[model samples]
Target: MDAAPLAARVTRIATLVAGLPALPPDDGSRYSPRRLTVSWLLEAESVHTEIAHARDLGAFLDWCNRERLDPLTARPTDLAQFKVWRGAGTGGTPAAASTVARALASISSWYTHLVANTDGGVTRNPVAAVKRPPVNRHTSTTAGLTLDEVDALLAAADAQAGARAAAAGRTPTGQARYLAALRDRALLRLLADLGLRISEALDRDLGDLSNNAGHRTLRFVGKGGVHRERPLTPHSLQALDEYLAARAAAAGTTADRLSGPIFATTGAGGDGRLAEPNIFMTLRRLARIAGIASADRLSPHSLRHAFATGAREAGIALEDVQDAMGHADPRTTRRYDRDRHNLDRDPAFVLGARRASRRSGNQR
Candidate 1:
């Protein structure tokens, strides 16, 4: 947690808040945008938000340092080089376009913020100066699990949970691991069925899920603190029930059984809310255990993608898919619609039996 070199520059910038010597239009662009990005984001209350912003900022800084480039003097050519470096191989495998797109967006937003807040003193976004890598949102091959794969994952989770429960002993460590297995099963099933973001899945209290007349639903705050409710699928509800039973057994006595996170940490933290990174680790491990082909790409978001895609394939309307996935924009949901984009499974080919029959009759 030691302060970065930019820390000193930011401290100096704070001093110049009131009456600073203004930069001349052409030649006075000497302050590093790298320093400005770190300071600006950290100062704008973004430190408490998504950590990806800081990660992207740090990566950009590292890229600049390695290239012997000054952020203040970076041009369109430098931006293009960064894009190439970001998209191409580390070990003969290219990075995902989505990842490069996010990093570019972070850098672009940093420059835009500087331009706006600094009275256009920093006039240009270097990212805007170059062509960004094309993100093929409509073409996501490894974007999600198939429905059978999702079911297989859930089955694997259940089998593992049963095994752990059977082997669990009186020892604290053994009990915690057993409980963690149970929790992971429920968590994975929830995400797989509900199409929830990791943040939404993790940010839940015990009371968030409620049952009425044998129908169950979850009410929780989503992005932008928007409160939303989604009906629970039967499999998700059953998995949840099993999880709660296991949770009670894991709670022992000292742990509160009724309040706090629905998916609490059963590992070293013991009843503390499980963090997002751990959720990711759990999903990855589960995906590997389930023998998923694209285990590396299987994340909580991937499960969400699976849910949306599977729903679309089942003949659900586009708007319904959007509503179920809690997407404010249909366009966002469209990206998750792998079935819609899958030309090989086109209805024109699959459902053209009458045309085939007519051709056969004419030939006869």
Candidate 2:
């Protein structure tokens, strides 16, 4: 197969995908007017998906070039071959169903858009005929803590702060860690109650906490650099108040140290906002102190999962959960709702299974 023709087509597709006007078709050969239209339509529709769509689309085009098949003449077998190649195991890890699905869907959409605009370049989407690989949403391991565990962790943080207060030393090292523990207690509460991502929580400044009309709120930029202001829960407010007061006192009576980041560096080194790694290491140490099972299994995200899960079980609205978590899509929130993941919740287990009158029941 000639790589030059394929490279030209890929280049045209790339140019359009980058939201640039297409270069004038080269002197050699040109794609149909309908194909160009389809490319732009796919581009317009894929803005929300961004680079992931571009990547999947590029892979499919490369595969089509390797097979020497145009969309106009591409058969169902060609689509199947692409799927097999993409879904093959990497090292020992199997390619995720979600990954395979994305690739197939991108190719399928391209063909679909072309078919919609074309007279006869393509008759049908080959992907439409093939069964989509199943993505089991329940298989995710986004774990949450039970309320008792949550209580224990928070209590452990408070206990550590108290212990550190009593263990005051002349050296700044001990006091720095002590202040850090106080910060960690507050951080844990924010994550467990407010449902903040670690980055969102850490990126907050001192001024982000404000009150309006008797309601306290915390402001931060979420994913996609979208700023969000959520009213503080009572529990979270109380924790924040205690933490902030402790933080202020820990940094001395001066107001300068309190001017910036809500979570400043402590524990003997580093400054100007606590990094995510510091937060993680702090949580790990706190988790061990709290007697939680494994270091690797527990994370700040677990607290977030706990927040969402606990809210769901307490009957908070799903949209409320989405907004509070700063999820871009409600479907993403639904995925985080672990309520349906439990095997015991299935209808296969009836609460009371009657023997159905042993005399009348016939054995299979």
Candidate 3:
């Protein structure tokens, strides 16, 4: 019997009422409960601004129902008005072309659902009548570290930080230094040796890295949900062993556990309970330390690209590279080598050379 709880109940009812679709022929039957729920989920999935856009769309449909405007009979002009209204005002800024396309797709899905279930057989979907905005193809080339640059980065990483840490155990000032070196070296070797996406690398759990005949082999999932296996190269295997040893020493925990993130902070305390490193933060740190090009977007992806390109330049086959990178589509793998391969035979280079002397040019 409290006013506050009563007010809360009324507010919830009001919100649900605001989200309902327009009424059908028979007043009570038009806005079926099932239709409304499905429409809500459909619209929610389609638009990025789900709640507001769904409310607006529901309001518009409700208006059409009040006016007895049959969606089946609605013309292109009505849809155009809706598009203009969407771009101009009501709730939020103009939707992206992709967003609009998705909204239309949601509408189509609802209509199709109705067609299959309801007695009011749908003749044609209204969304198909609307034309979508044209999208421009992005023609700019993708930039990645070249083979020489990749070598330089790995060498720089090894010489600048990796090597110094490896020598940490020789003296008393180097204990923590040794652990840090092993971790970083393991990270770099994983990136260079396996051509792993940063996300893929960081997603690894302790169980993902397994030992087979003293050789470390990694099993992980890749893009588009494909499972792949990559044998750790000798260099990477050594780094991993060192890193695991260092990790076990710091945590006083078993490295061969079936749980916990594969890579984590060495020491415990203050949220360092053996968790994964954020990919973005890790890449930013690497860029700062490596002193690579500041103009290019050099993230963990750059490391993957460098690995693929380096292998290709070293005469590794496209199919092998595709399997190694866990790319479902070989065409995606081909893009990595397109620019580098073209540079080898670029016409601009061949034709732009200065001709010293045309000594035999018809004896002048």
The model with the greatest lDDT is 1
lDDT of 3 by residue, 47-97 (tens): 223444455457457656766676645666676666555555446666666
**Poorest 10 consecutive residues of model 2 by lDDT?**
20-29
State every prediction's TM-score relative to the real structure.
0.73, 0.58, 0.54
> How would you encode candidate 2's per-residue C-alpha lDDT over 320-344 as one tens digit per residue?
8988898878777877676656676
lDDT of 1 by residue, 1-364 (tens): 1255348536544443322122222323444443454456555422223356656656766788778776655787888898898888479899888888888888787777778666555777888978767887655654578888888888888888888876677687778778888888888988988888887877687778776567788987776567888888888878777777767755553223555678888766465677788877777777788898887767678888888889888888989999887778888888887677688767788669779989999999
Candidate 3 or 1, higher lDDT: 1
CA lDDT, every model vs. true structure: 0.73, 0.70, 0.60
Q: Positional deviation of 157 in candidate 3, in angstroms?
A: 3.2
- By TM-score, highest first, what's the ranking? 1, 2, 3
Worst 10 residues of 3 by lDDT: 268-277
Q: Over the full model, what C-alpha lDDT does candidate 3 score relative to the true structure?
A: 0.60
* Top-TM-score candidate index: 1
Where model 1 places Cα greater than 4 Å from the true spot, the runs are 1-49, 119-123, 141-143, 205-207, 210-215, 221-226, 252-257, 328-331, 341-364
